[model samples]
Target: MTIRLIRGAAVAAAMVSGVAACSAPSGGSGGGESAYSVVIGVASEPDTLSPLLGYGKDGNSKIFDGLLARDADLKLRPALAKALPEVGDDGLTYTYTLRDGVEFSDGRPLTASDVVFTYETVLDEKTNNTARSELDAIKAVRADGDDKVAFTLKYPYAPFAGRTVLPIVPEHVAGDQDPNTGSFNTKPIGTGPYVLSAWSRGEKLTFKANPRYWGGAPKVKTVTMAIIEDDDVRATRLRSGDLDGAILPPNLAATYKNDSDESDSGKKTYVAKSYDFRAVTLPTENEVTGDRAIRQALDVAVDRQAMADKILDGAGRPAYGPLPIDDPWFTKDTERGQDLDKAKQILDRAGWKTGVDGVRAKDGQRATFVLRYPSGDKVREDHALAYASDAKKAGIDVKAESATWEVIEPRMKDDAVLAGGGSTGDPDFGLYTLLNSSLAGDGFNNMGRYDNPAVDKALDTGRRNQDEATRRAAYDMVQRELVKDPGYTFLTHIDHVYVLADRWRGLTTQLEPHEHGFASGPGWNIEDWQPKQ
Candidate 1:
């Protein structure tokens, strides 16, 4: 929220690390004039550090930046670009004039060519970025000059300008290598405020301030992120003073409430409102989950408010769909509440009769399926368990299990996975890849293999239409269809909670995306941070 204009950041995934040594006071990272550093604990790490492969696709990439960036209010602002883009009246074209003197970490100038290359490569058929569909509206991208880039879209995509937040990669550095397996995947060059210092894979990632950053060098000399996927482990590290800060669940974060009384020795807490949500995939391939009766019944049966109040410790809200209840795009008609009786009626009419064990059965298939969550994620695990409890009341057996993403990926074909996704900007940013039929089972997009022709068409119309009313109607149809045939049982929308060692003056939180604080929370403007006087 307190973005330093001498501006310039995302989180990539990594293995857990012991960074207790980084708990040093201000001069640990740099000496003399640059005597400021901070370390934080994050849950996941990026598979590849390259933007071409989808790292930092949501902006605040830290090491890289998009042509444009968002303010603390989530409004579009100039980053690599000199100003916002000018769109044609038809809404098919967007053109931006690049900021002069913006140089990559390698001291090379950033131009329109780099912007064009970044988009072109990601849109290439051979590239492995699953987020390509997010850019499906782009018909062509052209460099007008050294500082100007123009994009022509197939339709008047209303959210096209916001999509420019896709981080730009140095064409000279990344364009020469294979985007999928290039050396640059681990080592990248960008025009952001920080440059990668060392990547200890499963341990920690270290970064140094870019002295030649266009906005002027950041005051915070170095930043380190310690990957700690387990909630208790992260909380313990923060408690032991082994970390400067960390994102923690509401229950764990509340334990530190008494410590804030003595401000000098304790940390401050922040509650960042977000669109991030937790939902269960009801895969279309599973006999039990694929049934309309099971899907519909489970959708209405789950006590969304119970999960929000009990599991989240009142830090979040019940998620009716991907959008938060307060989101402008949310359809009020799609809101559902606990109705166990109605759920039983839906199942009974569908012939899913209760058998000898109190579990429903239709034909020869039993009403049961395994619910998977990423191992060590307590928030997701709690959500899965709560969902299972709700399913039990309706005569369905939801066996919840925990596993790493490696084990959960293949099983996603038929098994339900506790998943998280949502974005701060346009509805298309959060919905298209999640519900589009063409993207079913492609990496994480549409993991349930949901196929409703009406939803699919509405998604397209919502994405392509220029009229606001038309887009709203299209999205309303999409949400209504999901309620009619729920593909995923949305549990709750999370408001990310973080406890921080308050040693700096500029610390603040932003309206975050699905990535939470890892890429776009309080540290979204880390470059502007200054050591307390």
Candidate 2:
């Protein structure tokens, strides 16, 4: 089931329980000084905090602080490491020196040994880490002194710098455990501004400010994330004053703006921001959608503009192909647009004909296939509905369904799914992981079962070239190939939307490619955030 619908169930339950029954935690607000408590809603709970195993954005940003952090303009800035890496003339080895005096919440000192342990553990096949593919090009990692860490790569990967965003775990804590199976996943120790105080699975996670943090104490001492799946319910809770903030769906955002004046609390509005694109994946191995003609027909059938307007409510722009228009590698000459006439022509050429009921039929097959999305993901659900509607015009029978990742993951080889992928800082960090054939079935990405020799070649060339012009050309070729084969139907990139309490101030939003929780959102600069007097 999609996450949106799973959340819808919670919303229904909350409505029955009475929205007014929800109440804020007791006590006087922290008087604009000292400390304060804030509540935010997440669509789902994170799987783990261990960097070796953590793939989702929520945990990645919380328990781990990267060597480099992206600024408001998306430029690289130092976090744990003092500066960008110093590369060898050969371009095959890169070295970084850690900043002195940084300490993990557990009181352990951050050292080059910890960085070595973190990277080595992630690369170990025994770890079964989803991020292994990201480090596949790396040949060796070792610590020279207490502060210097060096990496030798099998190839000169241009994107290696951005991949350094993964958090460094303490060697003292993780050294003894087998990287494959460790209990530390549940309880992680890191140098981030916040420390996990308590976590009750499927309910809530509580975080407290880390006074010993190298970055200094966060102004908001207590941060609570409640697992609420429904969009409507989250919005309702925001309105009822049960939460300090929540991420509202695009369709419901307007409702909040329009109805704010009607409520007794007066009007509550939020600053909206956008990032990341959504797409639908058609596993090339699936019998129903495996045909190139069928995939091309579906792409042509989709009315990208109409979906953006009606479903996204002017919050999104039409996707041209696999890459977003804003991406530097995106080709302006790529072919992506709706054409019903061309769609019909392609299906007819493929020997699929309209049946008595108007659905396409080929070789006793009813052109039918299951289109699945996470039960609680409203954004994906809306996309699935839009695609299904458009497919009908091309005489295709697309049956949309909702299923959990537990169910959909195992069936990915045989079914088409509505899915989205994002990253921490750069386009390569996301694109390479999703399209690289070596990453298929790895975990963090490669969900589409898509493998193309051309894409792999381009990724390799792009990563090794180093020169800006050559690297851009390689990535441009990759995008062009994707536009032709189109393993996934591209959709619009969405802005990050948040609704927060009036008193909360100094929240900074990033155009993060993936949703990585507080660290990537307003909480990134929590130490500098202050309450209104």
* Per-residue lDDT over 440-497 for candidate 2, one digit per residue giving the tens place of the 0 to 100 score: 7555366666799999998877766778888788878888887667777777666566
How high is each candidate's TM-score?
Answer: 0.94, 0.90
**What tens digits encode model 1's per-residue C-alpha lDDT throughout 264-379?**
24578888998888889899999888898999999989999999898999999999898898989899978889999999999999999999999999898899999988778888
Among all windows of ten consecutive residues in candidate 2, which has the lowest summed lDDT?
1-10
Best by lDDT: 1
Best by TM-score: 1
Give residue 226's error in model 1 in angstroms: 0.5
On a 0 to 1 TM-score scale, where does candidate 1 land against the true structure?
Answer: 0.94
Q: How close is candidate 2 to the true structure, as a TM-score?
A: 0.90
> Any runs in candidate 2 off by more than 4 Å, and if so which?
1-35, 55-60, 257-275
In angstroms, the error of model 1 at 305 is 0.8
